[model samples]
Target: MTLRHAAFAAAAAMLLMGPAHAAELEKLWEIDGLKQPESALYDASGGVIFVSEVVGDMRAKDGDGQISKVSPEGKVVQSGWVKGLNAPKGLGLSGGKLYAADIDELVEIDVASGKVTARHKVEGAVFLNDIVTDGAGRVYVSDSGTNTISVLESGEVKPWLRNDRLNSPNGLAIEGDAMVVASFGKPAAAGQEAVPGFLVEAPLSGDSVRTLGDGSPIGALDGLVVLGGGKYLATDYIKGGLLRIDQSGSFETLAPLPSGTADLSYDPQTKTAFVPQNKEGKLTAFRIP
Candidate 1:
């Protein structure tokens, strides 16, 4: 069989052997009064959740963006907890600092005082989408528009990986020595819809990138959370759904969500997921089984 046909065949086999039943998604509570909530991060030590909101145009460097604090039980404790940001999309917490992926820079905020302490600008960065820490005091941010991943190590910012095959990488998570990325897909035209995304595993020690599963399209994948045992929970940004995928690239639709399901935070303790519906301006909590 040709490469394309072989890929399709493998995908078909995966579909047949994937999970027969979808997980139960029980709605918990919803937080309203948010403007384009883009990402959610759970603070385990503080027992709170921090959400990023792009109050203005995502590409525009307007100072209307802000971050909010939500209680564990789904209350907006402080809507404007930290303000004066510009289109903050993703968030990461490391070493008592909350890092935000702003339009062209990574903004660092002091977690204790909730104050903007530093801003590390990425040279030639256009759209920095997702931010994550590798548990080693290193902050990694994905620049989708530039097709690059920038790293902040030892108080410096530099481009770590620049690969055109990334295809507008969005959500990111560190798995072992590799960085698993969820793509937003390549744009069809200057002002057209994306081509649908998939998952890719890129090794931190090398420049190689390998597609997960049969390399078939998943969706406009947004946020990604590793669910241990070689499984993951991902969000489809355009199609509007939550999905569970195994190591073999087999996927099962867990729940259908509204469009604009952005970055998500999953708490394994309670089997709960905090999802941000940006266009709907709502933050919802769902129990996943």
Candidate 2:
């Protein structure tokens, strides 16, 4: 089989309700990692990088399952040691306060205090996947299990966009007054064709959902972020690579982010994108040309 067909087959396997470990991925970089390190973010002001080690071995770091901070020279370190979190998936930081979305709750941590200052309840949330903050400081959480988006305002948990039809909402992005989400379709069935995922544009003020590009062969569009100028950079789990989609739904292949990335972040000021894959356990950096 050709490379593209092989990737499609891999995605078909994923849709059939199998684990990510079931497939072998193309090597993106020469990096060795941990059990499942999901999402990553760039802290430009502090000159440090942060990534979520979702499920880790205590012998590797500590039992806290903290977010690792790697420096420019590849020196690895950690901060905000969150102890016994029920799988911290995606992380976001604003004004130096770190926000973590674990399966059960959204917790706020203050590095100065080294304590979880506040924790809020996410309603109808069976699994809280990704947590992100738009520049205005409003926090959004992708509750994948309930098919809803949870918003945090002034430290209070508020529900937003509850729609069951949204099958497997995997990633979050802000696009001109709406939340552009990538939906990976329902579980794959044996011998059934793998369902293709698409980018849906949902307004922030209300529930007006519209699909931008239908029948997207890229399949599982996970960990998306604005690439500036109304375009996006997304991780394609099925294809075992990264993808770039423009404003008009025109897309191009970005690069390889194999091992399935969870959440992605970019520093436009520096033109760098950080991809964190749970299965890869390695934080890889890509410079947008």
Candidate 3:
């Protein structure tokens, strides 16, 4: 065969096999009737999922916010498992407590009794968006409005990192000694500009910031999940999509959804992911491989 023919055949073979074997997300289930569900947490041991329902305007302090309990099979076990919150967003589980990021406080809930345990007010915080807990029991909460990260240690909330380079930090996760953050990009007025979001990494014990994924914007990122081994999954809130970013900062789209993918939860053992479609008012699960 001619060299050109052989090359063409090889290219065709790759095209045929690429998508068939590429990473994909299989829809497992979806739970509807949620009022602006914004975050999901998969509790493997309890076999339940906790979803944050931001009922009214995101910025309003309307005491109508709550958390809902759902089964792994996408059933709303209790629509209002915990109530009386104010614009709750991100959620993290540690020390037998569930820490939720409210507008300006880190609200802690007793996981066993579904009761409010403590509300640690972050001084001068605005739009607290995401929460994470490290192995040392240090709780980190991100403030998107102020572009700062606050820490809860020894019952005190203090600023951990404050840098303009954060660019509206939204979602956060702890990977080893580094803190992974999904930025909402530079803030802009409506119709003034279209600023794409990105990701960054900071040392847990230091104050340096490093951009991720080829230094290119990823489009209004929200929920971030570390998929182990220098890989991560981040949801695009504006585009309503999911992406897999490798250690080297290269990314690929796993799914393109409606424009409301908020905070995400994943189970490593099952390779299952739970995403709350905020505007759609639904909680969807997908099996990622």
Best by lDDT: 1
lDDT values, one for every candidate: 0.90, 0.70, 0.89
Candidate 3: minimum summed lDDT over ten consecutive residues — where?
16-25
Q: Tell me the alpha-carbon RMSD of every candidate.
A: 8.3, 11.5, 3.1
lDDT order of candidates, top first: 1, 3, 2
**What does candidate 1's lDDT look like per residue over 166-204, in tens digits?**
889899999898999998897567888668888888998
**TM-scores of the models, in the given order?**
0.90, 0.79, 0.91
Q: Candidate 3 residues 118-223, lDDT tens each?
A: 9999999989999888877889999999989999998899999998888899999988888889998864587777688788889988488888657787778899
Over the stretch 75-126, how does candidate 2's per-residue lDDT look in tens digits? Answer: 5665444565556777877766888877757878775555778877776677
Model 2: lDDT equals 0.70
Which scores better on TM-score, 1 or 3? Answer: 3
Q: Least accurate stretch of 10 residues (summed lDDT) in model 1?
A: 18-27
For each predicted model, how many residue pairs clash, with residues at least 3 apart or on different chains? 0, 5, 1
Which candidate tops TM-score? 3
